[model samples]
Target: MTEGRKMRFAMVCSSNQNRSMEAHTLLKRHGLDVASYGTGAHVKLPGPSLHEPNVYEFGTPYKTMYEELRRKDPDLYKRNGILPMLKRNLAVKNAPQRWQDNAADGIFDVVMTFEERVFDMVIEDMNNREQKLMKAVLIINLEVKDNHEEAAAGAKVALELCKELEATDSWEDTIDDIVAKFEREQERRILYSISFY
Candidate 1:
């Protein structure tokens, strides 16, 4: 463990509904300091058809989204897993937060993104920011599918990564070793870069 406090973590994905929330819940349940965000213009969920999606602003409450989707099509939403996903999201956080909006709230030791696009956005955002703290942060991209099953599996892998990271006091010094071990064991390649707060 670190000398001062536990490491802080952030999980990011496209809409912050499925993948990020899944990992967020697992990390939080393990008593790790963690937060999750979405790198999207708006929160989106699947609707009755492929072309139409249920889109809401960033600050819309999960309960409100759940009720609206349920009201719109109780059977369809339930069958498609949107209702359950919203309920799980409600348990984790009140609303979906945009990554750019919340990036400056505080410093995080590690920021994990679920997709390559989100990873790129996070890196760009970090590079654009004025580094006030000079604190080093590791931004890792572990591509996870947006679906429920893949999210659950990805969350488990994320939790394992956190466990390995927390085992060392100086993560920056040992991150490469941890990543190499994880990749060898899990057969999943991890893309990582260092940024500043």
Candidate 2:
């Protein structure tokens, strides 16, 4: 509700697959202006581990990746639900947009990331913007476990955050309150207010 304009939010993940897409879908469903992107140097996933994914550059079409993945290991991609995620991603964006690319488009009221690595990348990207955005963007780091089940749960949390923002008139203050409330809790939940410059 900053200046009565609808909030524009961004969600980021490593590969632009599970976590970010989940949050993006929920936020968009709520009619919020939102986008999701990855901070990875290359599109990656369906690998032996998170650290090692079949890497491809940003803006590489999802269809091409899907084909390559199928050719490489049909069963592996199918088992990991990679193709479904790829299809969903392609339906939304023509190709993956890196966090820096998304930032160049426009400033977001709140930029939320599902991982600490992405959180750092966002801050760095913001700092490197050619023209400084006068307003403060509350960069939130929500520690989401990167699995299908956890992504769904993270989507719910993302929806909650969007609802909280929708109800408030002050964007930064509401973010502050949400962060403080989360920090006070003992159990696992969204964490914020760490390095939101």
| Candidate number with greatest lDDT | 1
- Candidates' C-alpha lDDT: 0.90, 0.76
Q: After superposition, which runs of candidate 2 have C-alpha atoms over 4 Å from their true positions? A: 1-5, 48-52, 182-189, 193-197
Score candidate 1 by TM-score against the native.
0.96
Deviation from native of the Cα of residue 67 in model 1, angstroms: 0.4
**Model 1: residues with Cα > 4 Å off, grouped in runs:** 1-5
The CA-based lDDT of model 2 is what? 0.76
CA error at residue 160 for candidate 2, angstroms: 0.8
Best by TM-score: 1
For every model shown, what is its TM-score relative to the native structure? 0.96, 0.83
lDDT (Cα, tens digit) per residue for candidate 2, span 1-197: 34444788888899746799878877887788988888877777757576767888888888999888888888888888887788777776677778877635777777888988888888777767654436767788888989888988988887777667656777665666665665564254654542332
